[model samples]
Target: MKTKSTTLLLTAITGSLILLLGSGCGKKTVMPPETTMDGGADAGTPISYPAAEGGGYSEESLPIEGSLDDTSTATSVTAAEGMAEPTEEYKKLYGRSTRGLSPIYFNFDQATIRPDMVAKMESNSEYIRQIPNAYVVIEGNTDDRGTNEYNIALAERRAQNTKQYLVDLGTDPARVRTVSYGEEKPLFFGQDEISYSQNRRADFIIE
Candidate 1:
Protein backbone atom coordinates (compact mmCIF):
# COMPACT_ATOMS: atom_id res chain seq x y z
CA MET A 1 0.00 0.00 0.00
CA LYS A 2 2.85 2.44 0.83
CA THR A 3 4.58 1.70 -2.46
CA LYS A 4 1.28 2.26 -4.30
CA SER A 5 0.85 5.69 -2.45
CA THR A 6 4.37 6.78 -3.53
CA THR A 7 3.68 6.00 -7.22
CA LEU A 8 0.33 7.93 -7.14
CA LEU A 9 2.00 11.00 -5.51
CA LEU A 10 4.75 11.05 -8.20
CA THR A 11 2.17 10.86 -11.01
CA ALA A 12 0.09 13.73 -9.47
CA ILE A 13 3.18 15.99 -9.16
CA THR A 14 4.15 15.37 -12.80
CA GLY A 15 0.57 16.11 -13.99
CA SER A 16 0.46 19.43 -11.96
CA LEU A 17 3.83 20.59 -13.46
CA ILE A 18 2.60 19.90 -16.99
CA LEU A 19 -0.63 21.89 -16.36
CA LEU A 20 1.37 24.87 -15.09
CA LEU A 21 3.73 24.90 -18.08
CA GLY A 22 0.86 24.61 -20.57
CA SER A 23 -0.97 27.58 -18.97
CA GLY A 24 2.26 29.71 -19.03
CA CYS A 25 2.72 29.48 -22.85
CA GLY A 26 1.95 33.01 -24.33
CA LYS A 27 0.66 34.13 -27.76
CA LYS A 28 2.97 35.79 -30.34
CA THR A 29 2.14 39.35 -31.71
CA VAL A 30 2.72 40.15 -35.41
CA MET A 31 3.86 43.63 -36.71
CA PRO A 32 3.47 45.28 -40.16
CA PRO A 33 6.21 44.81 -42.76
CA GLU A 34 8.69 47.66 -43.53
CA THR A 35 9.81 49.47 -46.74
CA THR A 36 13.38 50.27 -47.85
CA MET A 37 14.90 53.46 -49.39
CA ASP A 38 15.29 51.79 -52.82
CA GLY A 39 11.48 51.38 -52.88
CA GLY A 40 12.00 47.80 -51.88
CA ALA A 41 10.33 45.80 -49.12
CA ASP A 42 11.94 45.59 -45.66
CA ALA A 43 10.86 43.46 -42.73
CA GLY A 44 10.51 46.47 -40.34
CA THR A 45 10.57 49.74 -42.41
CA PRO A 46 7.35 51.54 -43.56
CA ILE A 47 7.35 53.40 -46.95
CA SER A 48 5.51 53.61 -50.25
CA TYR A 49 6.80 51.95 -53.43
CA PRO A 50 6.01 52.94 -56.99
CA ALA A 51 3.98 50.64 -59.17
CA ALA A 52 6.17 48.09 -61.00
CA GLU A 53 5.84 46.86 -64.56
CA GLY A 54 2.97 44.39 -65.01
CA GLY A 55 1.83 45.53 -61.47
CA GLY A 56 4.19 43.35 -59.43
CA TYR A 57 7.28 43.83 -57.23
CA SER A 58 10.82 43.62 -58.64
CA GLU A 59 13.97 44.58 -56.68
CA GLU A 60 15.66 45.85 -59.85
CA SER A 61 13.11 48.70 -60.28
CA LEU A 62 14.66 52.19 -60.61
CA PRO A 63 13.53 55.04 -58.30
CA ILE A 64 12.30 58.31 -59.80
CA GLU A 65 14.65 61.14 -58.73
CA GLY A 66 13.07 64.54 -59.55
CA SER A 67 10.47 66.25 -61.75
CA LEU A 68 9.51 63.69 -64.42
CA ASP A 69 9.16 64.88 -68.07
CA ASP A 70 10.16 68.49 -67.28
CA THR A 71 9.95 70.62 -70.49
CA SER A 72 10.62 74.13 -69.05
CA THR A 73 14.27 73.96 -70.19
CA ALA A 74 13.35 73.14 -73.79
CA THR A 75 11.06 76.16 -74.42
CA SER A 76 12.09 79.20 -72.36
CA VAL A 77 9.04 81.46 -71.93
CA THR A 78 9.72 84.93 -70.53
CA ALA A 79 6.62 87.09 -70.00
CA ALA A 80 6.87 90.83 -70.57
CA GLU A 81 6.16 93.19 -67.69
CA GLY A 82 2.94 95.33 -67.81
CA MET A 83 1.74 93.48 -70.92
CA ALA A 84 -1.25 91.26 -71.53
CA GLU A 85 -0.41 87.64 -72.35
CA PRO A 86 -0.71 86.32 -75.91
CA THR A 87 -4.32 85.70 -76.90
CA GLU A 88 -5.37 82.05 -76.73
CA GLU A 89 -6.09 79.95 -79.86
CA TYR A 90 -9.83 80.54 -79.47
CA LYS A 91 -9.26 84.30 -79.06
CA LYS A 92 -7.05 84.26 -82.16
CA LEU A 93 -9.87 82.62 -84.11
CA TYR A 94 -11.93 85.83 -83.86
CA GLY A 95 -9.82 88.90 -84.44
CA ARG A 96 -10.78 92.60 -84.12
CA SER A 97 -14.31 93.41 -85.26
CA THR A 98 -15.12 95.05 -88.61
CA ARG A 99 -18.21 96.46 -86.84
CA GLY A 100 -19.45 95.84 -83.23
CA LEU A 101 -20.08 97.31 -79.78
CA SER A 102 -17.53 99.47 -78.01
CA PRO A 103 -15.66 98.05 -75.01
CA ILE A 104 -18.06 97.74 -72.03
CA TYR A 105 -16.73 97.89 -68.48
CA PHE A 106 -18.29 96.10 -65.50
CA ASN A 107 -18.16 96.52 -61.75
CA PHE A 108 -15.60 94.40 -59.87
CA ASP A 109 -16.26 90.65 -60.06
CA GLN A 110 -19.71 91.26 -61.55
CA ALA A 111 -21.10 89.58 -64.68
CA THR A 112 -24.49 91.31 -64.48
CA ILE A 113 -25.31 94.16 -66.84
CA ARG A 114 -25.71 97.63 -65.31
CA PRO A 115 -28.84 99.67 -66.04
CA ASP A 116 -26.80 102.16 -68.09
CA MET A 117 -25.23 99.53 -70.39
CA VAL A 118 -28.64 98.27 -71.55
CA ALA A 119 -29.04 101.03 -74.15
CA LYS A 120 -25.56 100.40 -75.54
CA MET A 121 -26.17 96.65 -75.88
CA GLU A 122 -29.59 97.33 -77.45
CA SER A 123 -27.97 99.57 -80.01
CA ASN A 124 -25.22 96.99 -80.54
CA SER A 125 -27.82 94.32 -81.20
CA GLU A 126 -29.44 96.48 -83.88
CA TYR A 127 -26.04 96.91 -85.54
CA ILE A 128 -25.45 93.13 -85.44
CA ARG A 129 -28.92 92.57 -86.97
CA GLN A 130 -28.13 94.94 -89.85
CA ILE A 131 -25.24 92.81 -91.05
CA PRO A 132 -26.03 89.21 -91.93
CA ASN A 133 -23.18 86.66 -91.27
CA ALA A 134 -21.82 89.18 -88.75
CA TYR A 135 -20.24 87.30 -85.82
CA VAL A 136 -18.84 88.77 -82.62
CA VAL A 137 -16.22 87.47 -80.16
CA ILE A 138 -16.87 88.48 -76.54
CA GLU A 139 -13.69 88.77 -74.47
CA GLY A 140 -13.99 88.55 -70.68
CA ASN A 141 -11.33 90.05 -68.41
CA THR A 142 -10.43 90.50 -64.74
CA ASP A 143 -7.88 92.37 -62.61
CA ASP A 144 -4.59 90.76 -61.64
CA ARG A 145 -5.32 89.29 -58.22
CA GLY A 146 -6.30 85.63 -58.51
CA THR A 147 -4.69 82.65 -60.20
CA ASN A 148 -4.12 83.06 -63.94
CA GLU A 149 -6.01 79.93 -64.95
CA TYR A 150 -8.93 80.68 -62.62
CA ASN A 151 -9.18 84.26 -63.91
CA ILE A 152 -9.26 82.91 -67.46
CA ALA A 153 -12.30 80.82 -66.62
CA LEU A 154 -13.93 83.76 -64.81
CA ALA A 155 -13.27 86.07 -67.73
CA GLU A 156 -14.70 83.51 -70.09
CA ARG A 157 -17.85 83.36 -67.98
CA ARG A 158 -18.19 87.16 -68.07
CA ALA A 159 -17.89 87.11 -71.87
CA GLN A 160 -20.39 84.27 -72.17
CA ASN A 161 -22.83 86.05 -69.87
CA THR A 162 -22.63 89.16 -71.98
CA LYS A 163 -23.13 87.10 -75.13
CA GLN A 164 -26.17 85.37 -73.64
CA TYR A 165 -27.72 88.76 -72.78
CA LEU A 166 -27.26 89.83 -76.38
CA VAL A 167 -28.74 86.57 -77.61
CA ASP A 168 -31.79 87.10 -75.41
CA LEU A 169 -32.09 90.55 -76.97
CA GLY A 170 -32.33 88.99 -80.51
CA THR A 171 -28.68 88.63 -81.58
CA ASP A 172 -28.03 85.36 -83.43
CA PRO A 173 -26.44 82.67 -81.25
CA ALA A 174 -24.48 81.31 -84.23
CA ARG A 175 -22.71 84.67 -84.67
CA VAL A 176 -21.21 84.85 -81.18
CA ARG A 177 -17.96 83.38 -79.82
CA THR A 178 -16.53 83.78 -76.32
CA VAL A 179 -13.09 83.85 -74.66
CA SER A 180 -11.97 84.33 -71.05
CA TYR A 181 -8.70 86.24 -70.71
CA GLY A 182 -9.02 86.03 -66.90
CA GLU A 183 -6.68 88.40 -65.10
CA GLU A 184 -4.31 88.57 -68.05
CA LYS A 185 -5.63 91.89 -69.41
CA PRO A 186 -5.96 95.22 -67.64
CA LEU A 187 -6.20 98.72 -69.09
CA PHE A 188 -4.95 100.18 -65.81
CA PHE A 189 -2.05 98.41 -64.10
CA GLY A 190 -2.05 98.30 -60.26
CA GLN A 191 -2.84 96.05 -57.27
CA ASP A 192 -5.71 98.21 -56.00
CA GLU A 193 -9.35 97.01 -56.10
CA ILE A 194 -10.27 99.95 -58.40
CA SER A 195 -7.86 98.74 -61.06
CA TYR A 196 -9.19 95.22 -60.64
CA SER A 197 -12.76 96.44 -60.98
CA GLN A 198 -11.89 98.29 -64.17
CA ASN A 199 -10.31 95.16 -65.62
CA ARG A 200 -13.44 93.10 -64.95
CA ARG A 201 -15.08 94.00 -68.22
CA ALA A 202 -16.19 92.53 -71.58
CA ASP A 203 -15.12 93.71 -75.02
CA PHE A 204 -16.72 92.82 -78.34
CA ILE A 205 -14.85 91.88 -81.53
CA ILE A 206 -17.04 91.86 -84.63
CA GLU A 207 -16.15 89.77 -87.62
Candidate 2:
Protein backbone atom coordinates (compact mmCIF):
# COMPACT_ATOMS: atom_id res chain seq x y z
CA MET A 1 0.00 0.00 0.00
CA LYS A 2 2.89 2.46 0.80
CA THR A 3 4.42 1.74 -2.61
CA LYS A 4 1.03 2.29 -4.31
CA SER A 5 0.62 5.69 -2.49
CA THR A 6 4.11 6.83 -3.65
CA THR A 7 3.30 5.86 -7.27
CA LEU A 8 -0.01 7.79 -7.17
CA LEU A 9 1.81 10.94 -5.76
CA LEU A 10 4.38 10.80 -8.61
CA THR A 11 1.59 10.50 -11.25
CA ALA A 12 -0.29 13.53 -9.76
CA ILE A 13 2.87 15.66 -9.76
CA THR A 14 3.51 14.79 -13.40
CA GLY A 15 -0.09 15.67 -14.41
CA SER A 16 0.12 19.03 -12.52
CA LEU A 17 3.39 19.94 -14.34
CA ILE A 18 1.89 19.12 -17.76
CA LEU A 19 -1.24 21.23 -17.04
CA LEU A 20 0.90 24.20 -15.87
CA LEU A 21 3.00 24.12 -19.05
CA GLY A 22 -0.09 23.77 -21.27
CA SER A 23 -1.80 26.72 -19.58
CA GLY A 24 1.09 29.00 -20.57
CA CYS A 25 2.77 29.35 -17.23
CA GLY A 26 5.56 31.40 -18.90
CA LYS A 27 4.92 33.72 -21.92
CA LYS A 28 6.81 32.97 -25.10
CA THR A 29 8.74 35.81 -26.87
CA VAL A 30 8.36 36.12 -30.69
CA MET A 31 11.00 37.95 -32.74
CA PRO A 32 9.69 40.03 -35.71
CA PRO A 33 11.04 39.27 -39.21
CA GLU A 34 13.91 41.51 -40.35
CA THR A 35 13.06 44.40 -42.79
CA THR A 36 15.15 46.67 -45.05
CA MET A 37 14.71 50.11 -46.65
CA ASP A 38 11.94 49.14 -49.04
CA GLY A 39 9.24 50.02 -46.51
CA GLY A 40 9.49 46.99 -44.25
CA ALA A 41 10.06 44.56 -47.13
CA ASP A 42 12.71 41.84 -46.95
CA ALA A 43 16.10 42.74 -48.44
CA GLY A 44 15.75 40.20 -51.24
CA THR A 45 12.29 41.53 -52.26
CA PRO A 46 12.14 45.13 -53.60
CA ILE A 47 8.86 47.03 -54.06
CA SER A 48 8.60 49.72 -56.78
CA TYR A 49 6.11 52.59 -56.97
CA PRO A 50 4.91 54.48 -60.14
CA ALA A 51 6.03 51.90 -62.67
CA ALA A 52 8.31 52.87 -65.59
CA GLU A 53 8.61 51.17 -69.00
CA GLY A 54 10.56 48.18 -67.60
CA GLY A 55 8.32 47.82 -64.52
CA GLY A 56 10.72 49.83 -62.36
CA TYR A 57 10.37 52.94 -60.18
CA SER A 58 10.39 56.43 -61.79
CA GLU A 59 10.50 60.15 -60.87
CA GLU A 60 7.13 61.56 -59.75
CA SER A 61 5.23 63.67 -62.32
CA LEU A 62 8.08 65.58 -63.97
CA PRO A 63 7.18 68.45 -66.34
CA ILE A 64 8.48 68.61 -69.89
CA GLU A 65 11.24 71.26 -70.38
CA GLY A 66 11.29 73.08 -73.73
CA SER A 67 10.35 76.23 -75.61
CA LEU A 68 6.66 77.05 -76.17
CA ASP A 69 4.82 75.73 -79.24
CA ASP A 70 3.54 78.04 -82.00
CA THR A 71 0.10 78.30 -80.39
CA SER A 72 1.57 78.99 -76.94
CA THR A 73 3.95 81.59 -78.39
CA ALA A 74 1.05 83.29 -80.18
CA THR A 75 -1.08 83.45 -77.01
CA SER A 76 1.85 84.99 -75.14
CA VAL A 77 1.94 87.88 -77.65
CA THR A 78 0.54 91.15 -76.25
CA ALA A 79 -1.14 94.00 -78.15
CA ALA A 80 1.21 96.87 -79.05
CA GLU A 81 0.87 100.17 -77.13
CA GLY A 82 -0.04 102.13 -80.27
CA MET A 83 -2.87 99.70 -81.18
CA ALA A 84 -4.31 99.67 -77.64
CA GLU A 85 -6.96 102.39 -78.13
CA PRO A 86 -8.99 104.02 -80.93
CA THR A 87 -9.47 107.73 -81.77
CA GLU A 88 -12.81 109.66 -81.94
CA GLU A 89 -12.73 110.08 -85.75
CA TYR A 90 -12.45 106.30 -86.46
CA LYS A 91 -15.40 105.61 -84.15
CA LYS A 92 -17.55 108.27 -85.87
CA LEU A 93 -17.14 106.87 -89.44
CA TYR A 94 -18.04 103.23 -88.46
CA GLY A 95 -15.42 102.18 -91.06
CA ARG A 96 -18.06 103.19 -93.64
CA SER A 97 -19.45 100.39 -95.96
CA THR A 98 -17.55 97.63 -97.75
CA ARG A 99 -17.75 94.11 -99.31
CA GLY A 100 -17.29 90.89 -97.36
CA LEU A 101 -13.95 89.03 -96.96
CA SER A 102 -12.72 86.20 -94.74
CA PRO A 103 -13.48 86.52 -90.98
CA ILE A 104 -10.99 86.01 -88.10
CA TYR A 105 -12.03 85.04 -84.59
CA PHE A 106 -10.87 86.17 -81.10
CA ASN A 107 -11.03 84.92 -77.48
CA PHE A 108 -13.48 86.27 -74.91
CA ASP A 109 -12.53 89.80 -73.79
CA GLN A 110 -9.16 89.55 -75.58
CA ALA A 111 -7.80 91.56 -78.52
CA THR A 112 -4.85 89.22 -79.13
CA ILE A 113 -5.03 87.02 -82.25
CA ARG A 114 -5.36 83.32 -81.45
CA PRO A 115 -3.06 80.78 -83.11
CA ASP A 116 -5.90 79.14 -85.01
CA MET A 117 -6.82 82.51 -86.56
CA VAL A 118 -3.23 83.23 -87.61
CA ALA A 119 -3.58 81.38 -90.90
CA LYS A 120 -6.68 83.37 -91.81
CA MET A 121 -4.86 86.62 -91.13
CA GLU A 122 -1.95 85.55 -93.37
CA SER A 123 -4.28 84.64 -96.25
CA ASN A 124 -6.31 87.85 -95.88
CA SER A 125 -3.15 89.95 -95.77
CA GLU A 126 -1.92 88.22 -98.93
CA TYR A 127 -5.20 89.12 -100.66
CA ILE A 128 -4.91 92.73 -99.48
CA ARG A 129 -1.29 92.88 -100.68
CA GLN A 130 -2.21 91.42 -104.10
CA ILE A 131 -5.08 93.79 -104.85
CA PRO A 132 -4.35 97.21 -106.36
CA ASN A 133 -5.06 99.89 -103.73
CA ALA A 134 -7.51 97.60 -101.86
CA TYR A 135 -8.93 99.03 -98.64
CA VAL A 136 -9.92 96.74 -95.68
CA VAL A 137 -12.67 97.64 -93.20
CA ILE A 138 -12.30 95.52 -90.07
CA GLU A 139 -15.64 95.31 -88.25
CA GLY A 140 -15.27 93.93 -84.71
CA ASN A 141 -18.10 92.22 -82.80
CA THR A 142 -18.37 90.92 -79.24
CA ASP A 143 -20.54 88.63 -77.11
CA ASP A 144 -23.52 89.99 -75.12
CA ARG A 145 -21.78 90.03 -71.73
CA GLY A 146 -20.66 93.52 -70.65
CA THR A 147 -22.36 96.89 -71.00
CA ASN A 148 -22.92 98.40 -74.46
CA GLU A 149 -20.13 100.97 -74.02
CA TYR A 150 -17.70 98.37 -72.57
CA ASN A 151 -18.47 95.91 -75.36
CA ILE A 152 -17.92 98.73 -77.84
CA ALA A 153 -14.50 99.42 -76.34
CA LEU A 154 -13.58 95.71 -76.33
CA ALA A 155 -14.74 95.30 -79.92
CA GLU A 156 -12.76 98.42 -80.92
CA ARG A 157 -9.61 96.88 -79.47
CA ARG A 158 -10.27 93.65 -81.36
CA ALA A 159 -10.59 95.51 -84.70
CA GLN A 160 -7.54 97.65 -83.99
CA ASN A 161 -5.41 94.64 -83.06
CA THR A 162 -6.51 92.72 -86.15
CA LYS A 163 -5.67 95.74 -88.32
CA GLN A 164 -2.29 96.13 -86.63
CA TYR A 165 -1.45 92.46 -87.22
CA LEU A 166 -2.51 92.70 -90.86
CA VAL A 167 -0.33 95.78 -91.29
CA ASP A 168 2.58 93.87 -89.77
CA LEU A 169 2.01 91.15 -92.39
CA GLY A 170 2.76 93.67 -95.23
CA THR A 171 -0.69 95.27 -95.72
CA ASP A 172 -0.56 99.10 -95.92
CA PRO A 173 -1.77 100.66 -92.61
CA ALA A 174 -3.48 103.51 -94.50
CA ARG A 175 -5.56 101.01 -96.53
CA VAL A 176 -6.95 99.34 -93.37
CA ARG A 177 -9.86 100.78 -91.30
CA THR A 178 -11.57 99.47 -88.13
CA VAL A 179 -15.12 99.62 -86.72
CA SER A 180 -16.64 98.32 -83.49
CA TYR A 181 -20.16 96.84 -83.86
CA GLY A 182 -20.09 95.78 -80.20
CA GLU A 183 -23.06 93.50 -79.28
CA GLU A 184 -25.23 94.94 -82.08
CA LYS A 185 -24.42 92.46 -84.85
CA PRO A 186 -24.27 88.99 -83.23
CA LEU A 187 -24.20 86.13 -85.78
CA PHE A 188 -25.56 83.70 -83.20
CA PHE A 189 -28.55 84.59 -80.98
CA GLY A 190 -28.45 81.67 -78.52
CA GLN A 191 -27.40 82.16 -74.87
CA ASP A 192 -24.64 79.53 -74.79
CA GLU A 193 -20.86 79.26 -74.96
CA ILE A 194 -20.93 78.21 -78.62
CA SER A 195 -23.00 81.25 -79.59
CA TYR A 196 -21.02 83.61 -77.39
CA SER A 197 -17.72 82.34 -78.76
CA GLN A 198 -18.93 82.62 -82.34
CA ASN A 199 -19.89 86.29 -81.82
CA ARG A 200 -16.42 87.32 -80.58
CA ARG A 201 -14.70 88.01 -83.91
CA ALA A 202 -13.35 90.48 -86.49
CA ASP A 203 -14.78 90.36 -90.00
CA PHE A 204 -12.86 91.83 -92.95
CA ILE A 205 -14.63 93.89 -95.63
CA ILE A 206 -12.94 95.13 -98.82
CA GLU A 207 -13.69 98.63 -100.03
Candidate-wise lDDT, in order:
0.68, 0.73
lDDT of 1 by residue, 2-113 (tens): 9999999999999999999988878877874566666566745565566678986665353433222333222222232333322322222222223345556677667788
TM-score of each: 0.49, 0.52
Q: Put down candidate 2 lDDT per residue, 1-207, tens digits, no spaces.
A: 999999999999999999988888577899756545555745565432456677644553222232223232212212232222222232222222232246777788898999998887898888777786777889989999999999999999999999999989988899988999999987667899977887888888887
lDDT of 1 at 173: 93
Local lDDT at 30 for model 1: 86
Clashes of each: 6, 0
Candidate 2 matches the true fold with a TM-score of 0.52
Ten-residue region with minimum lDDT total, candidate 1:
88-97
* Model 1 pairs in collision: 34-45, 35-45, 97-206, 151-182, 152-182, 156-180
